[model samples]
Target: MSGLSIPIHPITHNPTEAWEQIKPTQRVIKLNVKTPTTPQNENMLRFVCMSDTHCLTSHLQFEIPDGDVFVHAGDFTRCGSAIEIEEFNSWIGSLPHKHKVVIAGNHELSFDPKFTCGPAARQQHKNAHTGGGLINEIPDLGIERAKLKAAVEAENTVNLITNATYLQDEPLTICGIKLYGTPWQPEFCNWAFNLPRGKQCLDKWDAIPAETDVLITHTPPVGHGDLCCTGVRAGCVELLSTVQSRVKPKYHVFGHIHEGYGVTSDGKIIFINASTCNINYVPVNPPIVFDVPIPPGFSK
Candidate 1:
């Protein structure tokens, strides 16, 4: 599967037009800084974000900027193997951030129950009801089902991530900020934690806490930072709806489309596509850093 090619589809919504139509009334600051620096205010908490490393942490060209919190938005591994998970955990453990949060991406095949042990896995088997027909006609791309099951049975891959706080449709608090992380995205090349574009994807987005201050997802909300180099938008439409209409977090962090790396805002919420890797799989992008003012009552 080294040279695997996934089909790309053009996104129906035009992000530029969408942003222009609902222009933010208030001035939203865009934080696409080059160097990492301490927060100017004592009450501000700095966040260092990176995603889509894909087992290339060692090849990063720049030092990970120091901050109060570190957020990894997924795709830390190429295939989510046990060795890859262990190496990622070790690399994360070396980071100095006091609070680190992580979530799975499509590449974390072993972490997703649906792909490892549920319907997706069953699709690999021959369908007896259809007279020995195969459910998925795509050739097996070398990911052995037996190995995945064996790895899961040996030990849960989630437990291997002991260094950072892993979230899956879960929430965690750091310095009074409510952060929720989810891995689901619109189905892309039938990877892990993927669901259909409509209701299934919406169902996952619906579980995000309404009071979340920061939203971390593997897939970018459509139009924010989801454009691929091939001129297609790889973002989830329902996710964009959920974020703007309901969650409305102060910052939305994500990285899946490697080419879509940067920061954008819609007058209200800030969106960050912190993909450390470029489209060529090189760790050329710098980690995104931002400062969030701590709530008056909250102490660091």
Candidate 2:
């Protein structure tokens, strides 16, 4: 009745008594209506995952399929500088995915002061290029660190990237699925999210909720997807224990060791190293895609 064009049924009564005397024929009418079907994507959530873009968005040689959600494990910029972060943010904003989730990595020095202040790790991994701010090779390392810290404080470095949902030791729920994201990883090259190997890393992993459906971390758990070309296991053992024993997420997505871009499963869980870039710092790897069915009895 509110200006909507809906079907209406009409009835009329005969006033004369002769109407009843006369034989009347019955007539029936049926109205057919169509109900719209829901979109196929509405029934399932598709996640397109990638990581370690390293300020090489435009150079990507692969196509990212349309998806409901996009997950970036981190290291989107070469040095997490204002320019780098801004460019990354623009690229993230341009993605067609409905929801985008991201976390900071060791290379994102502007996001973490401790990483920028610490001396560079003795070993530098492949494609770990240095940009502005804290450069360990400089003769005046202290002065460089101080200068970087001053820039971060003055400009609020993290504020530069605001296009995606940034997570740091946080959990979020989307489309009836629980997601927890943290950037922390085993201490390496004194980068952001680096924590000492033993209890420190364990304490960080402990914060992950037991019901996390999708776990997004910059570093993979030990022996899962943390293999480097140098024949070293850069993952944290405590993190692996926590994931296998307690968290047990349906999908553990990460990317830091570029050489470890692939997928693995441990009977119960699926581990995806969705590194979009390769060891040579080339953004040639394809984005990983997976579908998660809607939970039973779940409604929007």
Candidate 3:
């Protein structure tokens, strides 16, 4: 079926209900990555996915399984401070994965131009009077406010992550699989990379390449892994429309709503919400792993 034919309206509020509604029509595969698994074909590439570490990689209690590719959906830092980025980079460098892909989350304010020097920054500046300064506007997150200010003002804050490929509306090919990463999501608490719902969000999704094999975003698509404990759906409706109808990637990986961590599918596309941290800000969730057959002419 074509993506355009899929019905995305009357957005489902409960993820379970949404899954049930499509269960019969779609083939869903829920894997337990925490347990030992049999070896797969050498021609396939294993992907280990995690997100929302929130600068707490050191607190992780479980061992990250080995994989050929490591994909971090987003939210690796608490406040996107320089120290946090450096620590994350250092930690990722220690991983055994041959290819690591990362994208900024809403918390990575320093990596987002719209939040640092655009209208959002101006708004923060205007509100600084109540809090003292831009640095003061942000709550104390262990990092000093003065240092955060410097990090935010620094050019090319994305460069701080040298260990992994940081993607922001860009594409990178790994083992012949074309993967595209985007960070924009619906406006949430005036966070970074936020755009108003509807056209603004749709425009960002439209930028995704149709030939993309793997799609990564900071936010989940509607009715997938986007249900919040508050009984609200936080995923992007426009993103779902774009994914189902246009991109149609083999895998759609994301993590923003910490509670919505799992794997779901629409029969056509596999949706994985690899949220490493739970709703309580604890790093208890395990990394999700999946394998994709190496495309023709591609060697791992």
lDDT of candidates 1 onward, in order: 0.78, 0.71, 0.81
Give me the runs in candidate 2 sitting further than 4 Å from their true place: 1-41, 115-154, 297-300
TM-score of structure candidate 3: 0.85
Model number with the top TM-score: 3
lDDT of 2 by residue, 101-194 (tens): 9998877866775533334321221113454433443333233554433333435667766888998889988888889999988767766667
Q: Which one wins on lDDT?
A: 3
Comparing candidate 1 with candidate 3, which one achieves the higher lDDT?
Answer: 3
| Candidate 2 clash figure, as a count | 1
Cα TM-score per model: 0.83, 0.75, 0.85
Count of clashes, each model:
0, 1, 1
Tell me which residue pairs clash in candidate 3: 3-245
What is the TM-score (0 to 1) of candidate 1? 0.83
Could you tell me the lDDT of residue 282 within candidate 1? 97
Top-down lDDT ranking: 3, 1, 2
